[model samples]
Target: MKHAQTFEIFLIAPPGLEQSLWKEARAKGFPSARYTTGGVTLKGGWEDVWRANLVMRGATRVLVRIGEFRAFHLAQLDKRCRKFDWAKYLRPDVPVRVEAVTNKKSKIYHAGAAKERVERAIAETLSAEISDEAPVTVKLRIDDNLCVFSLDTSGEALHKRGHKAAVGKAPMRETLAALFLGACGYDGQEPVLDPMCGSGTFVLEAAEIAAGMTPGRARSFAFEQLATFDGDAYAMVRATLPAPQRTSLSFHGSDRNAGAIENATANAERAGLSDNCHFRHASISDLQRPEGDPGLVIINPPYGARIGNKKQLFALYATLGTVLSERFSGWRVGIVTTDGQLARSTKLSFLPESAPIDHGGLRVKLFQTDPLP
Candidate 1:
């Protein structure tokens, strides 16, 4: 395994949050990080790939560009793939899956045929088994007659974080939650409060960040099955992470549903954040300021698109706005929703809306406000 060889690493960011993911990558020591259309790209070795999977909170998945070639057609692609150095990245014993996407500009416009060629090449040349259920996946993107091969180093989406067994009807993904927190200028020092917390994604993620906990600590990554993986070296990488920090600031979450409160509490316990995270069953009308300095008050309340009727939600939003404005003075606010009209109903002063983000097939934006006067 050539651990020292550098390659282009891509961190798939949530739609419209590429800049946030890029900032996080750079801050986490990937100085070469640059934002692209769908994700952030940087140059690093195998260990850096492992580290990105381990610590990056905003990335949905990490991919490594193993190699590339020019293929005018399926036959040419098959020939090049057979001759490529599969041994460098894949082991013969492990099953592999190949997926391909091609644009019309490419001569090899049939993605299915391209995928078959690559999978056959690996199975025949490297003597590896090909299975749809394989844990290791090779992603090939063909554009302008150039086929680029990338390995999905993170098998499961980074949002899974391997915790939180329970989820509500419309749960905010941890990746998006982390990015939203960043967009609100959260630095893990001040506390975070989610009035409409669902499964406690925002509160738990904030708690983990404040504690200096690695997001991937409890999860296994696809990179471990690659040929370049070295358990001892990876162990060293994990060992070098900053020791967990203890903070007095607490993360709080509340929900109108009792089951959501229970789920949030259990999730906090599973994430080892119970001590600093507090969850209770309370409606938006019942929300109160915690006994401490004002921090961030972020929530993903029910929008008409996913949960209930739009007309009825106005009163809910209005009541929420009234509660925050009347009680939680000096606290910043971030609201995630698909409807701008619903957001405006809050009657709170909001900054300009963020870029439209894709949430569960709906386009949503983050509405933010500076600390309340």
Candidate 2:
């Protein structure tokens, strides 16, 4: 098997949250990391790719640029792709899926045709079967007559951390939750409470971080099917992970729905974080600050656009603000909401707003407030 000493690695982030993800990548010691419009990029080896997939909390997917060439037409594209060393990068036994996109300036403008040509080249040169349902994917981009190929090393989206069997309506994705937690300055050392904790995403994520657990510990990746993958080396990478540290503080979550609390508790058990997290059935009006050093309180309340009526959500937000201000002073707060009016209804003195974040097709912003006086 052949491996490049260093190749381009792209980590996809949610729109408007690239800076947060970039900060995370840099803090993780990817010195070469820099943010693009939709993601961050770095130059790294296969091991770095493996590590990113296994450890990055904010990345939605990790892609590796394999190779590229300039070709104006289909025949040229086919000849060049065949000449490229497919066998060195792909395994003969693993089925592959190919996807392509082209710009207007490219002579090979048909995306379907381009994908078919590349698929045929791989099949002929490496004897790899092509399947639409294949776990491994080859992505192609033809812009200004230049062809670029990349591999989606992340099979399932990273947000599907392989533990939660139950999810609530408008459930926040784990990647998005991690980025929000980072934005709110939650470093896992302090206790966190989510008053509207629908499936306990915020609470569980905070617990995992506080416990020093890697988000990918429960999941697998697509790189395992590639020809260059070294199982033994990858096993060493996993083995070398520092043990998860014990946390002194417990995370708390509450929801009005008894079923949601039950689901959240079950999800915590499945993630092996029940000991560090506690879930209860309580509404926002009933919430009282847990006795501890003041920490962070974050919530993803019911958004008007996704679930409830806007008028109804306003009162809910206002009530939330009233409860937090009256009972949870000294705790910093972060709320994720789509409607600015709804966020304002909280009446909590918020700091400057965050960039609009894309969550489940709705634009949401994080509203933060300093420790209440």
- Model 2, residue 295: distance off in Å is 1.3
Candidate 2 backbone collisions, by pair = none
RMSD of 1: 0.9
lDDT tens digits by residue: candidate 2, 93-149: 999999999989988899999999999999999999999999999999999999999
The model with the greatest lDDT is 1
lDDT tens digits, residue span 1-373, model 1 = 4557998999999889999999999989999999999999999899999999999999999999999989997888989999999998999999999989999999999999999999999999999999999999999999999999999999989999998899988899999999999999998989999999989999998999899999999999999999999999999999999988889999999998899999999999998898999998999889889998999999998899899788899999999999999998899999999999989888999999999998889999999999998
Superposed model 1: Cα runs more than 4 Å off? 1-3
Write down the lDDT that model 1 would get.
0.93
lDDT of 1 at 22: 93
Model 2 lDDT, full chain set: 0.91
